[model samples]
Target chain A: MTDVNSVRPQARAETSVRPEEVLLPPVDVIEDAAGITLFADLPGVSRDRLGVHIEGDSLTIEGRILLPAPEGLEPIHTEVGLAVYRRVFTLSKELDPDRVAAEFNQGVLKLRIPKVEHAQPRRIAVQVA
Target chain B: MFYRSLFPRDVLAELDRLQRGMQQQGDVSPSIRGTGRGGYPAMNVGSTAQSVEIHAFAPGLDPASLDVQLDKGVLTIAGERPGVLPPKEAPATVHIDERFSGRFRRVVTLPDDVDPNAVSARYTDGVLHVSVQRRAAAQPRRINVV
Candidate 1:
């Protein structure tokens, strides 16, 4: 069995090299009747490189999007303003592990996390006594 | 062990040794792509009640070289952005770079209910925005109070 506690720190350290990749956009979390929706920005990433991992209370999202190298003339001077985007979030206890889903399109990452069935409000039928 | 009934002797023998050598290498890369941004031009996306807007942040793609297509609910942005200067000899320790250049492709999958025919695309402010409208059945419709 893998010890996530040990592995997680190493993964976290790897992220330090490309700190800018940690540029997670402002997340809009909406909890409606259906589920919780989280909107995250992921630029330059491809469908394949996008990663979503779940471990108990931890949810990790990371991808390394490579920017195209400059063309025509050789790079005499270069400043890479934006390289890649990466971020991770801790999942709340209410999250229904079985119902977590995500999709990435047009630089936006969508996470649909349904609340645990018990945590969700339920309607109780009343009987006239 | 169950599969041994199918494979030849040599192949099955290799499988046993292979299993002994294999080790957990840990996670290699992100399942989501663009994790390694790569050679394509950057693009932006915006979503609203009416449409999901996508913009390619490219300044060098020529109008004539651009080709946009929406096929089977997939939006593909393709264009050839010509490189500037084409690299030239410079004095000692000289290196030059301009941001935009080369061919790029960005393919995005739209929701099942997107109306491909009603889409609108334009290149303005050096950004190519493709607007895809939601299909009538999926769009919000006002109920008549009468």
Candidate 2:
């Protein structure tokens, strides 16, 4: 397991100007022979409010949460305040950026990034004498 | 290697003590006021004139799997989120595993004025919203001067 603290420095550097709180959504990244897949937990973010963009080696994910206050209700007790979620990852060149597939359901976002043809492993056959 | 496992428990206990000390200093976040426990799935509690609303910020949990219960005045939320990787296959090399997946339960005591019979809950996107109506006597009434 990659230490959660290790990934924060890079993401924090990317969003230095924002005065509002920028949450680092918890994520799971799995890498296999084919490629890598990333799953991010972004509760309260709807489909239209989510944004995923790749610029060169940097991959940034942003989600806006809209929480409407119920009518005629004065908030007596408040805890979890609303804030936008943002995170950035530095991607390697071996991953094919154009072929990425993404899906959002419930409150999780899944992104699949395939490896380039040359980056995929190939088995060789043995020749008989 | 054996010592590493034992070391964390001591470290964690120390950290907990330090956090408690910090909380006593009045620097803790107000939202976590009643719910003293920390880590995974933070929550918010709010109240209107007629109802009390609790918003649990838990994502990636199946809606049907969540268990919500109200006993006396305390509300309990329990659920589990299965790990993303397939179990049968060889473990894929993980780059990061910050997302926690396991059984979790959070219980918070509510005020005595809430009406248990008039509770409603809904799960949308990834938030579990639980609203319980308050008893008539608990609501604030405007006084008129003749």
The candidate scoring highest on DockQ is 2
What CAPRI grade goes to candidate 1?
A: incorrect
DockQ of 1: 0.01
When summed lDDT is taken over every stretch of 10 residues in candidate 2 chain B, the lowest stretch is B28-37
Error of 2 at B22 (Å): 2.0
Q: What TM value does model 1 have? A: 0.39
TM-score of chain A of 2: 0.76
Q: Write the per-residue lDDT of candidate 2 for residues B24-47, one digit (tens) a residue.
A: 676445445354435456777777
Worst 10 residues of 2 chain A by lDDT: A73-82
Give the B-chain TM-score of model 1: 0.65
B79-115 in candidate 1: lDDT tens per residue? Answer: 7755432234521121223233566787766667888
Worst 10-residue lDDT window, candidate 1 chain B? B90-99
Prediction RMSDs, each to the true structure: 25.0, 6.9
- Name every residue pair that clashes in candidate 2: A79-B31
